[model samples]
Target: MSYRAPWWLPGGNAQTIWAAKCSRRHAGAAPRWRRDRWSTPDGDFIDVDHAVYESRADAPLLVLFHGLEGSSESQYAIAFADFASRNGLAFAVPHFRGCSGELNWAPRAYHSGDHQEIDWLLSRFASLNPARPLIAVGISLGGNALLRWAAEWGEAAARRARAVAAVCSPLDLAAGGHAIGRGFNRQVYTRMFLSTMVPKAMRKWQQFPGLFDRDAMLRARDLYEFDNLFTAPLHGFKNTEDYWARASAKPLLADIRVPALALNALNDPFVPASSLPRQTEVGHHVTLWQPAQGGHVGFPVSHGPLGLPGHVLAMPEAVGAWLLQHC
Candidate 1:
């Protein structure tokens, strides 16, 4: 599970940042996604996109959970969809609360620990496809959520998904938030997140006037600031620190009971390596894949000096290989 960086992209930052850039540039034609609406118990709606392959009649289901502010259209999600479709698997990406390009009616938006949505999706998928195996892959923010969910569910989770894989998750949210606030991360990646997130929150405010404090959200600088101002209050946490403590999955890893794989890069800029859960700390079924290199969700971009496809496709390719052997 040690992912190698492409010869061209050296170090963790280069491997991470440049691979993301390449994925942005060459994700190719957008996949045709079928949008479906589901009613949440909270009186709000969530959007889920389905990508079907014509090749198979009853393919196993692969559920994908995207990063913060990302949707089915994200480059990595598209890559996984392609991988699923071509290999006799069906794919679906669940857009967290308001991230499906539509404003959710509720003032509450998604945070790092929304297990209700995960339960909703899993229950429905299991009901409809009684016999089909279920697999989940969570990336970044979504990855953390999935890991925590698995740990909480323990043996109960094993029945839902045969296997789970988390890629580049901020398992330790406090470390992650601080890491993104410092040095180049603050200037580039953190800024990129806030730029997209602030506008979305603003739109939600406009949609529910007087419900959310738009002024405070707009004044926030990065993830930690935004969470302190908007995310914490909306989600019932006392503050950002409280939210990070309760929401981080690192402490729960030892309890996870389902077959699972958690992947992280030693050089991942967003997730400090020191925060990753050690193998001995996790449950008997969990496996940690700390690839020496492979930035964020840019799996397809490269796979070490061994190198596969030119673009960022190595991730799905590697996952496919793993699934074939293990799942």
Candidate 2:
């Protein structure tokens, strides 16, 4: 399915903001959730929210990995969950470390290319229901990490999941990081992420005293500075430059072996279109969907009438269908 932005929601910023703030309100019929806390090998725990259709026990499982600081309740996550529920699919959203409304016990937190964690999670999920097909989808930061896992594991990745999809992910970390650190994006999006991120980092600092420079972290005004101070060092990268270079999924797109889809909006405020991969750049198994519209995760179909709000269901439904096709 193709996407055309609603006439009322023009441009990238408008679509992005509307989807983030209002999409959930129009999501309709909330799915019941069962939270499961799983302990990691590193002694840290991650919470997963599951929405299973008991009647369809043998159906394919849809695993969603959320974006930076995003949880199971994120607008995109909820939308995907609704899609799975309606389609008789089992859905799961695993919270990144320290993002489950509780601080993680480990000093190191999740990063944009935490493929090992992705590998572990998918492997466990696959083992839990070996008969059911597994389809994984990652959004934004989580998407990048998922692609990284697919690339790093090569053919082995197919053992854990039949297919994978990344929605609005920053495949080229350098381009995406620099883009989000400047202009109005820096003012609005960057600040918004730091607002929550800095406090969490400070809390982590309290857990491990002198883990990083608390004052420098406090002085961070953009994602670059914040990552340099916290994300990079905590996750074992030498610095922000090193982290962005090594963590990017773009350079390794050709290595992915399983059926994969990389969807990005051309005008995404966070991920610049120039950073998106072309058909020739990726492996034969990879599909690139660079729709001209749909800002970030926003793909509204129409402006609702009779005092209703526009809905952002087109993108998720399209992606969900694509994943199932591979299964």
Candidate 3:
């Protein structure tokens, strides 16, 4: 993958919050999307939203995984969807369990290390685009899971995709989670995630009685507390530490065999830069693309003929170009 300095995007703070804070920059973006559902063996269903390019029915496929609490309509996913269609590639996003606006049937929700679901989704996609090259892209939470899957699958991961790009994944999830739980991150992003998480867990707890502590979940002031009470117990982990340790993908990066690209921002508020793996720590096939800027999944763009201000180029444009060149 190619790297370009973010001279136009100013500071790391801008790169991190650009996509969320600067919605006006991405106005008038509406990509064609369709919905499909897959039933899991565990009595749950996964909803896949397709960003179709009907003109290129036989073209290669691009699978996307959205960030924590994000859906197919997320800004980055929308950018990728439009770019894929324009480039004659079929695009689809696998919404983890309850993130599809519908609660899953089973009590067991997805975590950062849930490889079984991602594996199943890839196997299902093979039949959909058997003749063409396939690639997967993951953002934030989704990225962590994808890397773990590839690492565990080893050389077998090539069956799913020749290459994978993970943008702003929390490689060392334990450190990342704890980092977000303290100081400025606790006041901002941690609350941002827990605001969505607590209510959703409440709804799920209502569905599955005797499964979690409602009082503790309701009292959670940060993501750590919420995970300590809710995510850990429901997902069958001993506690938050156990969940984060097992779910993190950092330790597994050395085992991945597929040509993988992992991008992390030096100033990402959600993931501490210190948690990032050294270049030598990863597998020979894995390439780490740590742009000095790019906050979390934020890669602000600034290129237009008419001196446009709000519209920056999308992250998918660069990554899609990389896949096309590599595949």
Candidate 4:
């Protein structure tokens, strides 16, 4: 396949490499976000990390989902929570399974299409506190998962949450994956994702010896290969192809009846501009924002006179305000 860099993936994916570099540059800079424990339906206890603003009673609840290889402690996660709290909204950042700083006991790991896990968490939240408005915000891979859930489950998931906002979602996962698989872009993501994922797979192997083909798992460096061998089979998908086919949000967008804000920059380094779905086709339920620049979450905020937050962090506010007005 001859790959043309999506306006997001600049210099034929050199920008993709730079995004990873910037992610590392700002890594570990986020403040300490709190962690909480919740029990799964299977009678397994799982630790879910979250960052909250103020008490849950007075404020509307906003749940956030982080990107690939991200946690509640990610800078955007903390910034969103901070913004929510400052504006009298309460929020929680749910760390994916095994990504919450504690190794999850369950044999399963988190994936972009893991709706059941999110369902379990939301159910718990509703049971504990009812009658409060709930909203969800997701970024990148997290955004993709939320979009898939909304598209697949529709009003069921929408009923549980008032509105959804997804930024930089790889809605067309297959396309996004293929886009990033080119040249140094492939190497950049493969290395970063594998660096974390391989260790986790290794840990799982330690707990359950002979569970995975150790050599094959090690050899799988990119997202597609690793996911096809491990995640797809475990999650009931025939393989990575099946998983990507089912999980990509493009097919489900028309089914989403609830209000949602989908924001992406033409210059985002992950998802290509052409991959962005047409908002008119999504009906009145979706709003698509295509900023000319952001560079895959690298919306640098200027502090000279106008103290505007980076576009990445300011997105929650924009969406939140829009939701309050529309929803």
Candidate with top lDDT is: 2
Which candidate number would show the highest TM-score if scored against the true structure? 2
lDDT of 1: 0.80
lDDT of 2: 0.90
Regions of candidate 3 where Cα sits further than 4 Å from its true position: 1-10, 23-29, 303-308, 312-314
lDDT of 2 by residue, 69-104 (tens): 999888888889888877888999989999989999
Descending-lDDT candidate ranking? 2, 3, 1, 4
Q: Write the residue-wise lDDT of candidate 4 on 173-268 in tens digits.
A: 887887766766677766877899989988988877776688999888688888877778767789888988887887778888778878877766
The alpha-carbon RMSD values of the candidates against the true structure, listed in the order shown, are 2.6, 1.4, 2.2, 4.9
Off by more than 4 A, model 1: 24-30, 55-57, 300-309, 324-326
Estimate, for each residue in 1-327, the C-alpha lDDT of model 3 and write its tens digit.
343434656666566666566633333447767899888888789999987447465678889988899889888888777777777888899899899999888886778887877788888898777887889988988999999899988878876787888888998988888888888788888888888888889888889886788887888998788878877877878999999999899998989998888888787878888999998899688888786776777777655564334443456777777767657
Report the alpha-carbon TM-score of model 2 versus the true structure.
0.97
Error of 4 at 55 (Å): 4.2
Per-residue lDDT tens digits for candidate 1, residues 1-327, read 645666777777777666666544234445678889988777998898998446454557888999988899787888888777667787889899888988888888888876666777788878877777888889899989998889888887887888888889999999999999999999989889898888888887788787566777778888888998778888899999999999988898888888888888877888888989898988678888887777676543543366544576667767655655545
User: Which window of ten consecutive residues has the lowest lDDT sum in model 4?
Assistant: 1-10
User: After aligning candidate 2 to the native by TM-score, how far in Å is the CA of 221 from where it should be?
Assistant: 0.2
**lDDT score at residue 268, model 4, on the 0-100 scale:** 67
Instruction: Kindly report which residue stretches of model 2 are placed more than 4 angstroms away from their true locations once superposed.
Output: 24-28, 303-308
Better of 1 and 2 by TM-score: 2
Task: State the C-alpha lDDT per candidate.
Answer: 0.80, 0.90, 0.80, 0.70
